[model samples]
Target: MNRPIAVVTGASAGIGEATARALAAEGFHVVLGARRLDLLKGIAAEVDGTAIELDVTSASSVAAFLDAVPKAKVLVNNAGGARGMASVADADEDHWRWMWETNVLGTLRLTKGLLPKLIDSGDGHVVTVTSIAAFEAYDNGSGYTSAKHAQSALHRTLRGELLGQPVRVTEVLPGMVETDFSVNRFDGDTTRAAAVYQGVVPLTADDVADVIAFAVTRPSHVNLDRIELKPRAQASASRVHRG
Candidate 1:
């Protein structure tokens, strides 16, 4: 079957993995990319898609991943994470660097590398999974919020840059998702990660994936510019109703 190709970054787990599954179910030949070849291979096998080892933070890896993609009708920039939550006064430079590299440059590298193919496909879609932090700022979360803001800017700018082109740009901003995101942010502190979602229900990876699948499946002319989804218990980045 000559299915349209949909490339998903950070496909080893969480949102990336779920998006890969959702896109595959949508009949797109999903190309899963991540540092975990083991997990990527398994997910790809299950989805009947291609698995490519990718570290979006590395330009060479992005180049190689893009080259492996014969054609790209959709690109899902989901390979990003946050690090230590430190106040501005005590900000850890290393954490900040990692955040900038993975969340900002990572998205840039992948999106820029596959842009032409997306345009050439004649009906392309770029779905960037940013965060509610993209617009809202919270204490001790400067590292992540700033990076997301920049990523969101890059994705949003494409709207005008690709005007009159066949490509569509959509940004998915999710709030308080219960994933390894917190665990990684806390440096593998699973207990801390568990506490993040202890008070209220958080959005699942599949929920975000479902939204992405719907956005890309829309008619070619209908462009869903930006979508912000969160659980009912969440009102904003800092205003979650925890009981």
Candidate 2:
């Protein structure tokens, strides 16, 4: 029998990368997808997996990646990030569009494109990484929060749609993860990014990755629908224990 295959998007860094590693260690043949070919190559070498260039915003790119991995049993939709810290009143329309393009449309396109492949696998599973912002909006979360809401909605709908099928859909909503997410979102403002988790134990990429691994590694009969994880210091999306 062929080994189970897993496809992970945004596998170049953070939770995505960590999840890929964990899955690979668990003996799944992982396919790493991301725009950074170099980073993907490095990860693939380390994990003994295949690497595919994937730009989630581009339909052609998404299609190409899916075509390349036609027998994926597990799909991890993890390519997304916030653009700016702007309130709804003054938020840039372009930023909102970009966020939606990546967080919503990207996920939809990839999931839809790979649905047939997943269904064919007989034991397929989808694990999407959402955020606490999906449920609780913050002050400057106009664009990102809205996009995450859409992502979570997709996961929920997929769970319902695949209820009768053998496929399983899981959504993971994590809070205040200590990753390069904030740094990239803030355009490399390291100080600001560090301040976001100052004096508080934040969730690590491995933490979320472990949850994702657990979700996918369940028995064929068990389907984990939604998982919400937060740092002890984080009470909600708006409230975090700071120094």
Candidate 3:
């Protein structure tokens, strides 16, 4: 009577936290990973899931996280964020480095680490949470955009590479959801963060989690390669309609 294991990174808050709850409701024994151990533990307690401290940007941390996961049926690569919005001409290397490491390399490490376990389960699924920036470029967003593009490419490539295998790879491209993303990008500027969602309603973390839950619940023969979701006010990364 054991439930399938689903490991969700960044499960401390936002989409990751919501997804963990959603999956748990669907009867999966969730393993929540994030650097925020206090938040992670609290959420895990509520969801009846395991809380493991994980810093996706660190190789040793990823290795240790993987050690805790003896087996997994699903892995959600959701631990990533933007650092800043400096223009290309004034781009901060530090910002770019963090973006690349977290979004691009982070996905690679987690997916590669769990692929064996996923495949062994006979119905493995890899869900990567990339941004709308993955397919569109916007001004002052080169670092975030580039990292998402690379992350998307990595996830998409697996669809073809693991075609004959039991593993399924799905890339989720989300436009805008109200979360700590903007606040973090602007260095704790809550004013700026609130402005991003003002005048126009944005998607909620639960909205995206609903999609992830749906994707994984589908039949084994049905593979959802890519899922792009956005609020009605958003048309693209740089195009959002405001009242």
Rank order (by lDDT, best first):
3, 1, 2
- What's the CA error at residue 205 for candidate 3, in Å? 0.1
Sort by TM-score, best first.
3, 1, 2
Supply the global lDDT for candidate 2. 0.91
TM-score of model 1 relative to the true fold? 0.98
lDDT of 3 by residue, 8-94 (tens): 999999999999999999999999999999999999999899999999999999999999999999999999999998999999999
**lDDT accuracy of residue 176 in candidate 1:** 81
What would the per-residue lDDT of candidate 1 be over residues 85-146, giving only the tens digit for each residue? 89999999999999999999999898888889999999999999999999999999999999
Instruction: Give Cα-based local distance difference scores for all models.
Output: 0.94, 0.91, 0.95
Model 2 clash pairs are: none
The total number of steric clashes, by the backbone 3 Å criterion, in model 3 comes to 0
